[model samples]
Target: MTQKISPNNYLITVANDRYANSTQLFRAAAMIHEVIHAYYHSVVDDNNSPTTNLSLNNFPALYQAYAQKTYPYGVTVAQHDQMATDYVVSMAMALQEYYYNNNPTPYPFLSYEVFTDLA
Candidate 1:
């Protein structure tokens, strides 16, 4: 969520409390979701009248296909549906890399199947 700080500025804050005691996997997923939100905001947010493109909010090619498929009325799904379908393996791999970096002895490998059940 966003809080309007002033006419020319906005503040977006992630509540780390939400991830307190959460596993690294979930933490990574949350981070990815927020990142997608940030990207969407960057692309579409234009003053008070946000502009969406023919490419489904002008999302890059990587996101355009699935976004066009799932965007309601060619608007947006808040990028969640596309994120779910496209970034699962990425999130899992990120988690694995993070764990390995923290503890190299125990390779924390995971398959994309770990996230297939989500959504």
Candidate 2:
């Protein structure tokens, strides 16, 4: 979940259940995805009026990589958010693979179902 707390600040929450019972790779990827979302939203204000400011157009590569090819110019606010989510998840997965090869100790672990349920 994403929420704008202030003018340029956002809060992104990732529930423990999201990665519960998943693989280490999946957990690491999800962590990266959420972190990226936090970073992206920090720079690009999603709550701003897209029609007036065209904030969505600022992320062209995100649009090209995740959105439909027909929308070459830009994407709607909803499309932009979805594209950001997809792009970050893909990037996170790739990063997780790289970390696995280089340094695997700090990778995210799968949440324990019992603990997650309690939380």
Best by TM-score: 1
Candidate 1: deviation at residue 54, Å? 9.7
Name the best candidate (by lDDT): 1
lDDT to native, each model: 0.57, 0.54
- TM-scores of the candidates are 0.52, 0.40
lDDT of 1 by residue, 1-119 (tens): 54445433456676778868887667665665666666555543433233433444334553556556667445356366556677767766665566557655666565656644331
Off by over 4 Å in 2: 46-94, 101-119
Q: Where does candidate 1 have its weakest 10-residue lDDT segment?
A: 44-53
Q: Candidate 2 lDDT (Cα, whole model)?
A: 0.54
**Residue 4 in candidate 2, Cα distance off native in Å:** 2.1
Clashing pairs in 2: none
Q: How far off is model 1, as Cα RMSD?
A: 7.0
